[model samples]
Target: MTRNRVLRQSKLLCAKGVFECEDLTTLNHGVFMSVKRKMSDEIKSVWSRNGANSYKEARDVVHRVEWEDYQHWLDLQWPKK
Candidate 1:
């Protein structure tokens, strides 16, 4: 896939309350620990209202992200600092 498609899907998932995009490295696992963070009420409403299709699309994007082998991103996300 293309770079644009990956970014778009990540944004979609971020909007769904399924994930966050602020630090993208941790997402390599498909599911991130940060998913436990509480979303605002408005975000919750939008997340709940999304259809199964959206969930599937987000999953696909996640898989792609994982396959990309985020070595550099992981370094940035987990810098020695």
Candidate 2:
């Protein structure tokens, strides 16, 4: 599927509180779940900065964020060398 489609699907999955999916797995982790959990603090900060009114809205904002922007955080969290 296309990148936007995958993002949309991931947002939907997060709304339903279902994080894991076979096709969406990366490094054996659910994309949304990994982002949400690993970067909870940062996500919360972004959510507040964006004035997201609800958890779902925050999640949508998170889904739309650029993954590359968090590369440093990801590297620190996973440290895959």
Candidate 3:
């Protein structure tokens, strides 16, 4: 599939609270790990800013931030040719 179409579908999934974005399955292991760590930090920041007392309280916002971060990493890794 075309890159833009794939990105669009993945973003739709993200909008639906899908936290993982492993669409480009061949992503380097180290890079994936790095992105995951970055996402964790973003989640923590959102959780604090929103005063979320528990994982459940931070669920929606965390998922959205996680997806957005992951998507951004994906874009950087696979910039349009």
Best by lDDT, which number? 2
Inter-residue clash pairs, candidate 2: none
Question: Model 3: how far is 74 from its true place, Å?
Answer: 18
Query: Which candidate would rank higher by lDDT, 2 or 3?
Result: 2
Candidate ordering by TM-score (highest first):
2, 3, 1
What is the per-residue lDDT of model 2 for residues 20-50, given as tens digits with 9 covering 90 to 100?
3344335323334545566565465222112
Best by TM-score: 2
Cα miss at 43, model 2 (Å)?
A: 4.0
Can you write out model 1's per-residue Cα lDDT over 1-81, one digit (the tens) per residue? Answer: 564465557667767776533333334332332121221211222221111111122223321223343343244332232
TM-scores, each model vs. reference: 0.18, 0.29, 0.26
- Pick out the ten consecutive residues of candidate 3 with the lowest summed lDDT: 47-56
Model 2 compared with the native: what TM-score? 0.29
Candidate 1: minimum summed lDDT over ten consecutive residues — where? Answer: 46-55
Candidate structures ordered by lDDT, highest first: 2, 3, 1
